[model samples]
Target: MDMRRTGAIEAVSDGGTVESIATKMGNSIDQNKTLQKTYMLVNLASVHAADESRKIGRKNIASQQNEIKS
Candidate 1:
């Protein structure tokens, strides 16, 4: 269902109390912020993993060059 319609349904379910609606809205916002922070952490982890992989690859390449010289 559309969000607006679902929200209206929720409001109705809560007996249309302003405080109840505002509290629900606040909870939703908090959940969204939590989700956003989680997404950022995952993105940062991916970047760090990629950087570590590059470092490993560079080390391998340098080792191979030393082996060739020897």
Candidate 2:
């Protein structure tokens, strides 16, 4: 979405008249579905990163506990 907004603005400005501007804007909005998918993928990646971090943290805590026991 952020990437699209920047590109859309440039496209609209380059077109410069009412009809051309509207056409560019409409095209930009239509392209938003791709951006939506990209956003979803990024969120999924973040969830994976967090899950991995939690597993690592738990393992480290267990290792510390074992060291203390010895």
Candidate 3:
């Protein structure tokens, strides 16, 4: 859950940052495209991190069960 929260924070922070950068770009087509790409990547990373955290949490439970079998 902590990882998910962190990722959510990071994703929101990056979105705000991109908005700031876009406002500054004004009329720069090249920069706007770059910023859009960055936004996509950052959000994608946040989503993946959250998913991995869930998988890790499940794996931990599996590990604990395996320990009891020994």
Question: Whose lDDT is greatest here?
Answer: 3
How many collisions between residues are there in candidate 3? 0
C-alpha RMSD (angstroms) for model 1: 14.2
State how far residue 12 of model 1 sits from its true place (Å): 37
Task: Check candidate 3 and list the clashing pairs.
Answer: none
Regions more than 4 Å wrong, model 3: 1-42
lDDT of 3 by residue, 1-70 (tens): 3543344346566664544444544534235665455443446667789999999999999999999998
Q: lDDT tens string, model 1, 1-70? A: 2564356445545456444544655544334555334322334457679989999999999999999999
Give model 1's TM-score versus the native structure: 0.40
* RMSD after CA superposition, every candidate: 14.2, 10.7, 7.7
Model 3 whole-model lDDT (C-alpha atoms)? 0.58
Q: What is the C-alpha lDDT of each candidate?
A: 0.55, 0.56, 0.58
Q: Which tens-of-lDDT digit does each residue in 1-70 have in candidate 2?
A: 6665555445544653334533645654334566434322334457679989999999999999999999
The residue pairs found clashing in candidate 1 are none
